[model samples]
Target: MALPERNNEGFLENAWQWDKATAEVIAAESGISLTDDHWEIIGLLREFYKQHEMSPPSNRLFVKAVKEILGEDKGNSIYLMQLFPGTPAKTACRIAGLPRPTNCL
Candidate 1:
């Protein structure tokens, strides 16, 4: 499928344009291979956006949300860092086609 339009940071310009294929393209551009674990986080991010109309504004908040939904083992910063590397909240939101977190650099 043709890729959707994306911003300079590679986030989908229109959130509605997001899909698994779009996410794959974005992740590939970032040199990430999307495993099932990655998909779980992506799904969680999307659901969070749907409910809150925004991405988590910080790693602490993201981790807390994950912990509430997915439990401590998968929700910690270490697991997220391993999955998205660098800034986990920013990278995951980008790949999930959500807006960048408010306070992220």
Candidate 2:
């Protein structure tokens, strides 16, 4: 299958183009070997985008949402950082085929 189109930052240009394969490609490009835990966050990010019409604007807000949905253990910043490394919200959004968080730089 053809690769989905992506922006300069490697986010999918069209969110509808996202799929598990595409997400794996993006994750691989980012040096991530996706785990079940990573997929959990990606699914949550996609759902969050569907409801909010945007990626969470800040890490704090993302963490809060995760806490509310997945509980405190997964919602903590350190755990998220461990999963996504540099910037959990931005990295997960990219892998999830969602737009970059407006507040992220």
Candidate 3:
């Protein structure tokens, strides 16, 4: 029931690292182009974490999110999968600068 510890390298080592400046570090490491849509999702993830203090479930990540802010139309998992297939859920969390999720383990 516990969450995974972030990479020893340090979670959110990228854009949001330990502080807001860490987001720059994350940007450099991600090597992927983060667009406005991506920022929208990441910001939502941060807000979700702030409210729940937990990562979203991978299974319903897109579904759960879209309904809340951007609406159900944007809740497709395909976009998330296409965007960060290598890490999909995990990398999304990384880009969002959140701690690793429990299911990711």
Question: What's the CA RMSD for each of the models?
Answer: 1.0, 0.9, 6.1
Which residues of candidate 3, in runs, are more than 4 Å off? 1-6, 13-21
So what's the TM-score on candidate 3? 0.69
- lDDT for each residue of candidate 3 in 8-30, tens digit (9 for 90 to 100): 73464333334334544564576
Model 2, 1-105: lDDT tens digits are 677888889888899889999988888988999999999999999999898888999888989999999999999999999999898899999999998888877
Count steric clashes of candidate 2: 0
List, in order, the clash count of every candidate structure. Answer: 0, 0, 7
Predicted candidate 1: what Cα RMSD to the true structure? 1.0
Evaluate all candidate structures by whole-model CA lDDT and list the values in order. Answer: 0.91, 0.91, 0.62
Which candidate tops TM-score?
2
The global Cα lDDT (0 to 1) of model 2 is: 0.91
Number of clashing pairs, model 3? 7
Task: Show model 1 residue runs off by greater than 4 Å.
Answer: none
- Where is model 2 more than 4 Å wrong at Cα? none
